[model samples]
Target chain A: MNSSSSGNVGIVIVSHSPKIAEGAADMVRQMVGNAVPLAWTGGDIDGGLGTNVAGILEAIETAWSPAGVAVLVDLGGAETNSEMAVEMLPEDRRARVVVCNAPVVEGAVIAATESSGGSPLAAVKRSAEEFYA
Target chain B: MHDAHASRPGETPVPLTASAVLVNKVGLHARPSIKLTQCAKGFTAKIELALAADGPWTDAKSPVKVMRVKAPQGATLHFRVAGPDGKAALAAVLALVHDGFGEV
Candidate 1:
């Protein structure tokens, strides 16, 4: 749902269920428009109901931005796997990426909204985390 | 002492206020909430939204907080803004709500 929008902070959504990931991405696209780079991933190699580190890494790659990338996960496993994916990033790229402690659906919307507004990675992460505040 | 989080400063001007009915079919749902936050963030004023006039205000620039209000249709939304751009900020948000977020 995003295209031709670069330089803005990117957002990657991770969930155990593929549908949840896609649905959240859809919501983000609808609310934030196509101004922010975005991607979603879930399930394992066989596309079952579980988090996949490789898929998450691919999603991060797809959503990567010079501005930065914020990763939102649905569950503990998703977050853990996303952390592994971030760790897999090149040393220089790792600093530009972060895994947020926020609700997946709501955080994706808030983060994408913040990113669409050209907010930096920290602000977008803070905006998403505010859901818990 | 200067406090950045203070609701009102010692020499602050009185806040501008406005109210609008949530006429959209689904009230302030995700799309509308995001739009409201975007509109509010365009200004430098301190904007807050509440169901009643007295308290329980939430930052209008936060989509999550705005959506959390879950204001169903027909709910009256009260707004308070304080800053040099308070008047324009209040007017913009009120207009967005008055238009029902472009939803008929």
Candidate 2:
């Protein structure tokens, strides 16, 4: 886990399928290189098709950026789990985290690129949300 | 010639515009869109990308808007840039497009 530098927002991808999350993160990495901090968690502790709150929490912690962190989930359940993971963080840390309402692959790519450019948390979240617009 | 003489200091720099075809196999999909958006952000100029040469431009700085063009292979992408660095921006973007985004 690389430490996130100041002014760089991080990205976390959550998905029911480990392949989906990992693949999306890989695509983002290829596009933005190491300019942004990124982490991801998918599947359950048993390696089944489900979201794991603990895994999500660890991903967020590993990719924690002082600028902020954006989480992109694949489905509603994953979104809920991601939200719960955020809630488990210290109050101050939780405030800087956002569970974005956007598609996993597209949102991760856009958010990662936006973060690489040193945009604020709000702008990064906006970039992901723009996928829906 | 006449336009150059008519322009005065403090006035806005003339916009640099160009059009190029999407030669990459995938067109402006995720990879290229991400690259294009990141490149656009590198410059301070205002950049717009449109599917047609005439109008209806979208901010090139936005990945979603760039992808919204939904341009397939062989489609033309028009770029309009304005600001002090518009020429550089236009040239860089055109070079990237002509390079087939490193595709082939």
User: What's the TM-score of every candidate structure?
Assistant: 0.87, 0.88
Best-performing candidate as measured by DockQ: 2
Clash tally for model 2: 0
lDDT of each: 0.89, 0.87
- lDDT tens string, model 2, B1-104? 75773375543456678999989999999788878888888888899998888879999999888888888999899999987677888898988888888886
Q: Global CA lDDT of candidate 1, please?
A: 0.89
Q: After superposition, how far is residue A88 of candidate 2 from its true place, in Å?
A: 1.9
- Model 2, residue B85: distance off in Å is 1.9
Task: Let me know the TM-score candidate 2 reaches against the reference structure.
Answer: 0.88
lDDT of 1 by residue, B8-98 (tens): 5542377788899999999999899999998888888899999999869999988888988999999999999988788888999999999
In candidate 1, how many Å is residue A99 off? 0.9
lDDT of 1 at B17: 81
DockQ of each: 0.58, 0.66
